[model samples]
Target: MSELGKKIATRESYGNALVELGKEHEDLIVLDADLAGATKTGIFKKAFPERHWDIGIAEANMTGIAAGLATCGKVPFISSFAMFAAGRNYEQVRNSIGYPHLNVKIGATHAGISVGEDGATHQCLEDLALMRAIPGMVVLNPADDVEARAAVHAAYDHVGPVYLRFGRLAVPVFNDEATYRFEIGKGIVLKEGKDVSVFATGLCVNEAREAEKLLAADGIDAEIINIHTIKPLDEKLVLASAAKTGKVVTIEEHSVIGGLGSAVCDILSEKQPTKVMKIGINDVFGESGPALELIQKYGLDAQSIYEKVKAFVKQN
Candidate 1:
């Protein structure tokens, strides 16, 4: 578990990864809708001033520009908050990027309830749902700094429209570079168990790991799987785990209606039927508060997950 005490934000890793990528790829261009500092594209702006573009709060126009750049053989990474980047510019992304299938990487930061003190308007709980709806869009939600760093390189290498989700809170680092590998559409099993399979994505992956420990203490061996990619999901891995455990619980920092929970249910309903429980926001908007407080309120915290899983395991 990250050598026991290292904590880093996924957004911090995204920004630093951009600097490292800038040194290698000359054709890599970054565009931000005047949120370079908040979205952490400021790191790229400082490293390669000529390659970075501040589009001044014009999210839709930024997508258009990135698409145009992509046509000329440039790999453009667009940066903005998830609400504005994915929600505000949905039409542009769908038509300009998705339709054309351009080489554009969208780095969406401040996603979900962890956006803390920003209230419902700033918090984006439906980004995964929105981005996943767009055809050919690669949706990536990195669990920690190490995965976030690797995801940046993977997105840059892949040719198509991609959405990279990053969080504002500093979560515990559970993966080490020496042992961890990031692959698009691949799920990583952190712990193997026979009782129940706990599928989680983004910041909730760490909570699932903690919940695993709590469940183990109570004689429940919970299998924990980290789903870093939401769309083009690892159906084989998910179905195999669910087949073994027979009980499933999905955790995410998104709306329960159309996020990782819905994605898992969609798979299970099609192939193998299993009793599933989804742990996320219950079709409600988030309020202004500390990140940890909001997590507890939404029942996405480790303790809450543990209690819910313990009950679900008993019932099933």
Candidate 2:
């Protein structure tokens, strides 16, 4: 495993990637809903003034414009908070982009309760479910800086609507930029073990790694796999891991109802029947608080995950 490196938010990586992609892919166009600053699309805006536009808080309108641009042979990327991009613009995205299968990339930043004190209105826990519900939509939730940037390139290469979820909180950069490989619909095994498989995504991946250490102290050998792509999930990898361990635990920052946990359950329940424990936000709304505090209070912190997994292993 690569050593843990500096912390960087995946949302920041999304913006930097757009600037680089714009330099190479001239057909690439960026559209923001008056949140270029927060979404970090302003970096692309400053670099390519003519190619980027602010739709002025009209997320649904921006979605339509992006779809129209896609039909005209332009690869348009729409940027906004996950709530507005995936939630508020669900209809436009489903009809305009998903229906025709347009090559439009949706960069939904500040997802999950990790958006800090932005509260429940801005924090989007249902984006994965919403995007996954759209037929032919490619859903991706990258784990770190390297994976996030690579996902942007992958989304551009994919010839259909893609939803990319990013976070506001800075997470540990554990993957080596030069050596790490990022592929859509593939999961990476960060650690190999035999007792149980701990599948994780987004910022929760780092916390899972930390929990792995605590689990080790208790003589629990937990396997860690980063499920970066939620939709088009790495079913083969998931089944292989579950077969090896006979037990599974899925961790994510979003709600357990329709996120990574649910996707994992859908696969394992059908092909490889195994014991599963889901660790994520319950079907409850988030409250205003510090990002780290919310994560802990909601029982997503490393210690909380460790305790829960330990109990699960002991009980089962």
lDDT of each: 0.93, 0.93
The sequence of per-residue lDDT tens digits that candidate 2 reaches over residues 222-274 is 99999999999999999999999998999999999988999999999999899
Model 1 quality (TM-score): 0.98
In angstroms, how far off is 141's CA in candidate 2? 0.5
lDDT of 1: 0.93
What's model 2's TM-score?
A: 0.98
Total clashes in model 2, counting residue pairs 3 or more apart in sequence or in different chains: 0
lDDT of 1 at 266: 96
For each candidate in turn, the TM-score is: 0.98, 0.98
- Which stretch of 10 consecutive residues in model 1 shows the poorest summed lDDT? 1-10
Task: State how far residue 220 of model 2 sits from its true place (Å).
Answer: 0.5
